[model samples]
Target: MRRRAVVFVALALALLTAAVGIWLAVAAAARDTDAAPPVSVSPSASAAPVTADDYCYVEAMIYYRVKEQELAETLLRKQGIEAGASGFATGIAARDEDELEDLRAWYLSWADARPAEPPTDGPCGGHGSDHAQMPGMPSWSALQGFAAAEHPDAEKRFAEILHAQNAGMIALVTLILEGDPHPAVAESAEAVLQQAEADQETLQGIIDAVP
Candidate 1:
C-alpha cells in the first residue's frame, strides 16, 4: 500500500510539471506578438504648381485692367449675338432673354471693375511699371476694339474667351493663396502676358469674321 501511494504521487507531480511548461510556452509566444511593431503607410505626394498658361491669363485680366474690360465687352457682345442667332436658327433653342441680360450685366460689371491707368506718379508705389512692361503686354485700345465686335457664329470665339478667363482666374487665386515671395511670382505674372497673346489671336479671328 505505501509503494502504490508513492507511485501515484510521483505521476501527479510529473503531470503538473508538463502542464506548467505548456502554459509557459504559450505565454512567451503571446508576449513576443504583443512586442512586434505595427505596419506604417506613407502619405500621398503634393500637387505640382499652377502652369504658365494659367498665370498669363490672370495677369492679363488683373494687371492690364482697361484692355481686359474692353476685351470683355467685345467678347460678351459676340457671345450674346451668337446665342441669339442660334435660338433663331434652331427651334429647340430656348431664348433665355433673362440669362442673356444677366450676361450683359456681368460684362458691364467686368468693365466697371477695371483700374484706371496709373499716373506717372504710379499706383501701388511704382510696382505697377515693373510688372507693366513685362512680356506679352497687350495694347489697351487694340484688345478693346477686338472685344467690341459682333459674332453671329461666336461659339469658337466664346470658347477661347472662356478658356482665357478660367486660366486667368486660376492664376489669380494661386497668387493670392501662395503669396508671391520668389522670382517665380514674376514668371507667373508673365503667364498673364501669354494669355493676352492668346486672347489677341482669338480676337483677330473674330475681327476677320466681322462683315
Candidate 2:
C-alpha cells in the first residue's frame, strides 16, 4: 500500500511540473505579443501644404490668356473675318477654343490651390478696378486696333500679336517647367508652348508673304 501511495505522489508531482512549464511558456508568449509598439504617422510630415506664391505664376498666366483668347474670338466673329481662312486664319477659331477651355480648367485649379491674397494681374477683379496683366502683354488699345483692322492690315496685326503672345508664352512656360511643383500643370504648359511656337512660325510665314 505504501509503495502504491509513493508512486501516486510521484505521478502528481510530474503532472504539476508540466502544468507550471506550460503556464510559464504561455506567459512568455503573451509578453512577446504585448512588446510590439503601435505605429504612428504625422500629418504635417506626410503632406506639406502648397503656398499661394507657389502657384501665383500659373494663376496670372491662366487669367490673362483666358481674357485675351476670349477677346480674339469675339473680335474675329464681330469683324466678319474668316475664322477658317485657308492660310492666315487657318484653325484659329478652333485653336482659340481649345486654348480657352484649357485656360479655364487651369485657372480654376490654380485659384483653388491659391490662398486668399490681393488679386494678381491676370485675375479679373469682380469689380472693373482690378485686372490681371502678364509679361509681354500688349495694351488694350493695341488689341482693339488689331481686332478692327481689315484683311491685309489685320493680317499684319495678327502676326505682330502672335509674336508677342508667343514670346510671353515661352517665358511663362519656362517658369512653370523649372519652378512649378504641379506635374500636370507643367505638362500642359509645355504642350501649349510647343503649339504656340509652331503657330508662330506659320503666322510669321504668312506675314512674310504679305509684301
Candidate 3:
C-alpha cells in the first residue's frame, strides 16, 4: 500500500511537470506572435512626379496659373461684382501662393532625385525662350471697361470676364495638371479646379441674386 501511494504521488508530480511545460511553451509562442510586426500584403502607394522634357512646359505652366489667379483676384477686388463671388474669388486667389510653393518643391525634388543627370532635357521645344506669353489677358481697355462701370453695368462686365477667364483657365490648368506633369503641380491643379467649380456655383448665385 505504501509503494502504491508513492507511485501515485510520483505520477501526479510528472503530470504536473508535463502540464506546466506545455503551458510555458504555449505562452512563449503567444509572446513571439504578439511581438511580430504585421506584414502588408500589398505594395505601398506611390507618388508620381512630372518628368519635364523641356523648360517651356515649366514657363507656360507658371504663367498660366498665375494669370488665372490674378484675374480672379482683380475682378473680385476692383469690380466688386458680388459679395458671394468675392468669397469665392478670395478662395481662388489664395491658391496662387500654394501652387508656387508646389512648383518650388517639385523643382527641388527633381534636382535632388537627379543629382548626377543635371536635367539635360533643357526647356520645352529645345529652348525656354520659345514659350509664348499666356493668352487671354484682358486688354487695358477691357480693364478700364470693368472698373469704370457702376452697379448693373459693372456686374454685367464682371460676368462676361468671369466666364471668359474660366474658359481660359481650363487649358492652363490642364497643362500644369498634365503638361508639366509634376505630382505637386497636378495636386495643386486639382485643388484649384475644385475651388473653381465651387466659385462657378457662387458666381451663378451672385448673378441670380444681384442682377
Candidate 4:
C-alpha cells in the first residue's frame, strides 16, 4: 500500500508539470505573436501650387496677344468695315506702305477724337475705359495696318500658332518637373521647349515690326 500511494503522488506531480509547461509555451507564443508586427503610419499627400513665374509668363503673353487683337478689331470697327469682312480683307490684303500709312492715320484720328476720361480704376484695369485705352498701345488703325502689312493672318493663324506652341512647351515642362518616368517623353518635351524658344524670337520680331 505505501508503494501504490507513492506512485500515485509521482503521477500527479508529472501531470501538473506537463500542464504548466503547455500553459507557459502558449503564453510565450501569445506574447511573440503580439510583438511580431509593428504599427505603421502613412504619409499625407498634397499637390504644390503653380509658381508666380508660371502665372506671370502665361498671363503676360496672353494679355499682350489679346490686346493686339482687340486693337485690330477696334480699328476695323471704326472704318465701317464689318468684322468678318475686315478680317477676311486683312488676311488677303497685299502688304503696302501707303495703305498701312493711311490705316495708321485713321487709327490716330479715332484715338484723338476721344477725350481722355479720368481713371476710375487702376492702371492694370486700363483706367476703366471701354477700350482699355492706355499709353503706348498702337492706335486701332495701326494695329489693323500691322495685321494687313506684316501678318495678313495675324489675328487667327498667327495667334493660333503661337498659342499652340507655347501651350505645348508649358505642358511639356510641367510634366518633366512633375517627375514623369518615361525617358522618351521627357526627351521629347525638352526638344519641344527648345524649338518653341526659337519660334518665340521670330514671333516677337513680327510683333516689333508692326507699324
User: For residues 3-58, could you state the per-residue lDDT of candidate 4 as single tens digits?
Assistant: 65654564454335433533332243344544222212122211223232222222
TM-score of each: 0.27, 0.57, 0.49, 0.26
Q: How well is each residue in 93-155 modelled by candidate 3, as lDDT tens digits?
A: 576545544343333334434323223333333222423223444554565565455555655
Better by TM-score, candidate 2 or 1: 2
Tell me the tens digit of each residue's lDDT in model 1 across 153-209.
Answer: 344443344345445445443543355322433453455445445545554554355
Residue ranges of candidate 1 with Cα displaced over 4 Å: 1-63, 66-80, 83-182
Every candidate's lDDT: 0.37, 0.51, 0.48, 0.37
Candidate 2 wrongly placed segments (more than 4 Å): 1-54, 78-90, 109-112, 118-131
Error (Å) of candidate 3 at residue 90 is 3.1
Ranking by TM-score: 2, 3, 1, 4
lDDT of 2 at 49: 43
Residue 154's lDDT within candidate 2 is 64
Q: Which ten residues in a row have the lowest lDDT in candidate 4?
A: 38-47
Best by lDDT: 2
